[model samples]
Target: MTRSPATPLPPPKARRRLRETAALTQTQLADRVGVTPGTVRAWESGRTTPRGRKREAYAKLLKTLAEEAAVQAPEPEPKPKLEPESRPQPQPEAKPQPEPEPKVEPEGKPQPQPDSQPQPQPVAAPEPVALTPAQAFDALYAFSAPALVRQTFLLTGRREQARESVERAFQTAWEHWPEVARDRDPVGWVRATAYEYALSPWQRLRPRHRHPEPPPADPGDRTLLNALLRLPPRHRRTLVLYDGVGLDLPETAAETEASTPATANRLLRAREAVAGRLPALADPQVLHRRLAELASNERLRAAEPPTVRRGGERRARLRTRAAIAFTVALVATTALTVRTAPTHYEPPVSPGQAVRGVPQRVAPGALSDEELELRQKLLDQMQDGPERLSPRLE
Candidate 1:
């Protein structure tokens, strides 16, 4: 017959045994349980007991330690035999005590009670801070010009056009620094602005029919740019700002002038579209290589001096400046027209003295629509006068 091995016995009821079994110094365990070595000594001496879960944890811990150490427990001492007695004696019964009465407080007097332990209070979350306009602008320019140009190329599918668009956008953003700088996502803001200009009526109406070739990827990056370029202008801008650039929803929405939910939807659709197209493309490595090549080419292109490519970028800068000047001129002209237009004040026709129709004097500058209308009305009134002025006697 097989015999079962005996289970190990517990260690001696001493503080040293606890310290050794728990693999902790008496001071360490006391500190951990928020007690002192003196209290631990009382527990180990059996003069006091550990309370609650800590006692169970410590007891089980010691048991596990003994098993791991493979120590054999000594046999328990045998109880002494009792001597036989001749006769039993009757014992007296004790009477039951009355229950304690509840305490009552007098009216209008508060009862004093011991203070309880303090409850833990929750900490408030820190607030999100906003960035200043100047700071925002600085952050945007902090991106290397090459990186910005590469991002533009990936979004637009044409390297030269992308570079031109980015340059114009930056120039415009710089000119309106105070305004664009207020934006939380200045990079995204500039990107969207570039997309708008690239798809503007003037650009669409231009005679050139050149189309962008699909970008060739390099080692580090290989995403195809064509998949993104095929999206509708707004969707493309939204996707490029979110997925390509890694802007959060709020920032993307602010940049695109779209609601957060709308921006999220656009990004989802854009991603789905790209994912759908990617399967047919077969090798993802090719796409990554093409993107890397695009980035490297963009870096090289940006490093070139502006004077060398003055023909293209110079024209772009001139066009942007002209557009700004024209916008300013248009606003000023509109304001002047509104401010100088003649007020429609009818000269209170004099109470008596043959009140004839009055003629209006045109302003020194070009005639305004208001002035023309007033003159026409006065002419009609004069033509209907009671009698013709005998040709205004000289």
Candidate 2:
């Protein structure tokens, strides 16, 4: 059976009236509607409209309250009034209509005829207004941050890393706002940054991340996520951007900084690896579906737009302070270099050290008197007699 469309909700003011007349507080209404008090408030205040089953339930509830109000407050009885007698009046005559006449021309002068065809007027396009850095940052963050957080989470199955990656990307974007804002695809710029941060080899070394995060509750999800994680980093990224994020081949290649064929190869290998584990996901569509479901099912939500913008600004300010401090340090180092530099030419100091470990030999004494006499006798013997050739037979 086809389900009828949900009843449209009443105006915000009338909706509030219905709730008030029904003596229901926002909390009470929210409880009955299966939503939060804040959602109910937003509904009544017209900040947002309720959707799906919630919308049906809310519409039915308001309709019931209105009907009840109508029943309880009956209409008042009609009152009688005095009627006055009246008389008839006069009639009038029709007048002749004036017609458009052709103009008369003087002899020998040429008469100009009106153009039968209508000319089209050119329309000036409205000028595009430029956004300030903060506004642009907020806009970009709002558009891409949530999906990015999820994408990062898929890339590295860690929630904290996912959030941190996006925030860091936006921070970097804001830090280099001029370049980023000027980029043809700022979202792509931010996404690339976030992806790089998320996929950094160093992130795996984080103390908290050393142990794998808890897997999805569903066995299939757990298996799929494990399969995704098992792929090489490059392959996994290509798969996520290609299948999960629905990016085309060339765009995925561009984002991954690889040639199209290389990206295709990585994707093929990644899918094969994933399919090896989950044979049902061998088809690309099924793989994409599973990847999306895995990412979506996680309890991932990014910070509000303002919070992200504020964080980006905070990071930008920190970078500015760091640059200023670095400049000051550089200036100080330069001054110290100038002050302590050698005043004049100087010989280079030798760095060589005496060789170690070998024994130092003592030169023979010039003479103890006996030793000198012995030495003189030996010298005389060598000069006069044949050299004393052998040590005594020892």
Q: Which candidate achieves the best TM-score against the true structure?
A: 2
Off by over 4 Å in 2: 1-131, 345-394
lDDT of each residue in 221-331, candidate 2, tens digit only:
888888888889899999998898898885676666554577899988998888788899999998888888988899988887778777777777887999999999999
| Candidate 2 colliding pairs | none
How much does candidate 2 score in TM-score?
0.54
lDDT of 1 by residue, 85-125 (tens): 74466788888989555455777555566667999999999
Kindly report which residue stretches of model 1 are placed more than 4 angstroms away from their true locations once superposed: 1-144, 180-185, 211-223, 280-300, 303-394
lDDT of 1: 0.61
Compared with the true structure, all predictions reach lDDT values of 0.61, 0.82
Instruction: Please state the error at residue 92 of candidate 2 in Å.
Output: 31
